[model samples]
Target: MIKKSIVFAAFDEEYVATIEFKLAKLTEERASIEFITDAGCLEAFLERPKKIDVLILPYGIMLPHPEAFSKTSIYYLTEEEMDAENPAYIYKYYSVKRMLEKIDSGLITEAESEKGTKVVGVFSASGGTGKTITALTLAHKLMKKGKRVIYISTVPYQDFTYYIDDASVLGTAFCYQCSINIKNALKIIQDEIKNEGFDFLPSFKNLPVSYQMKFSVYSQIVDYLRDKNIYDYIVVELSSELEADKLVFLKNCDWKVLLTTQDKIAVGKLEALLSNMLDFDRNILILCNRYKYNQPDFLSGAQLLQKYEFSEFIEEYNAPLDLEMTKNSQLFDRTILCME
Candidate 1:
């Protein structure tokens, strides 16, 4: 594949080097990077440019003539007000990952790449169904199996303070802000994120502050993440409380894992609900979570993939999965096989 040419320029050589290293790591060394440490060299290079796909430079430098690099998408890096206002200005103060994400997202659709991303939506009709735990365990297992995995949580007022330490890790919120112009915005679903060696956007600050905008910002981000071909598996943990957003998100998933309790009395209602709503998708899988050996597999009319009874805390499953250590590997492997 022909890699895109990216030229990043700044006055500080150390800062530029950090960005270069981070960008190369993030892109898997698939991008061609050119750095300019001297303002004189940058100006000289701008005098006669080649087929550079993207140009990002300090906002302090005077922008080159528009016709100089006609085919290039130019971005100005700024710490404060720009010398000249432009839509392509990127905040210099943001983290290196965030800055690179903004740059990468700009040209997301330009490259023709194959996607390995498979979205798994963990949802439940009712709460306390082990939805979040299931999602996290699945992500951990997939990571152990050598699949690039990310977990996203959409619970309102969530605080994974320990998981995400940086208060400045505003990936979800920043991605939402970019989604305001969803049409012009790159067709990416989630901001490229990492936490605890398990990729994820941190918990939301004031989740979905705009209802007038997209129904669920996450609904689109997951789809974008898949199309971008970044990760192999994307496990999303959604709140059972929000039905409308759940519906919107499930459409993008390759496999939908819906959890429910062993309530035989709720059978008729669940059958009608799953049939009327989720029956449209063949990939939907229903599971009776926290099940004993005797709990009915077909809690409703749907097929079952029940989670065996467990006494250990959910955190016990945090480390790399050892198939010898547990029985849930059966569930994890089955879901992965379907995705593969």
Candidate 2:
């Protein structure tokens, strides 16, 4: 049986939380729920990137263009008296069970999935170039703006758990081994990784396990997440070492961010690497981290861009060495956010 997909768009956090809590009681085999609290995100979601079986919005919230979502069945939750003749109207502040009953009565219909999610891959030629930091910071910034974002680290030696407390290392690995459906896998992820503000899937637990899993399995997991239409963005932090498997995975991403430093050796490696890459201009952005002016020995930003013939090159300002401090700085606001 196909699981019913439901989306709740509302401005009240408490109301959203209550609905989420109650929905968690339902079996994953029967239903899936996605919540949207941001107005912008709600608007984007209503665009119907994917088929939404039911969309719940509070009556007070203004939907600028109702006709645009004529394909989506909309239900208004109102505390005051609603049009008794309108079957789409549900009494607000009702129990979760009652609300779900209204949904089950066939107020909305489900359709096929839509492709709208964008996957971004952050990669570097070498370690210690702030690839993971950049990925996490970008995800955080998007999440701050009320976008549904998830971070996935494909590094063999997992360090993402250390930086982000309560992260579920090898959560995806568990799902893969169990051969769980995407709906159940998503539920497991939401339960395992809690209170992190955003979702994160860490690398494998050990090298042996990592080697045992094929690259195709990794691709399948990412593909399933992208097709689900649950998240707005998937930011991936890849390993520094490049292999055929890694390259294939990176190529599938919607966007690629190549991180590098001013070190001559690093720039040389990057230049040599980019020479053999095909279609490097499309959806690719090169970022020079820890940038400084009037540097000697190391290549300048303009020099690096000219040598590589890159379409887009950005100079990331040097920020505090501390991770927490760096996140609050202008680095992400001014540099990372500028990217599409």
Best by lDDT: 2
lDDT of 1 by residue, 21-140 (tens): 446655654578888889789888887677788899887576567687888888888765354345588865444544556667543332333457888888776776666656776786
Stretches of candidate 2 exceeding 4 Å from the true structure: 1-115, 171-195, 207-211, 292-294, 301-320
Residue pairs in collision within model 2: none
Q: C-alpha displacement of 4 in model 2, angstroms?
A: 47
Q: What CA root-mean-square deviation does each model show from the true structure?
A: 20.1, 15.3
Over 4 Å off in model 1, which ranges? Answer: 1-115, 159-192, 207-214, 242-245, 265-269, 278-281, 292-334, 337-339
Clashes of 1: 4
Candidate with the greatest TM-score versus the true structure: 2
Instruction: Give the TM-score comparing model 1 with the true structure, all chains together.
Output: 0.49
- The collision pairs in model 1 are 188-224, 189-221, 189-224, 189-225
Clashes of 2: 0
lDDT of 2 at 64: 67
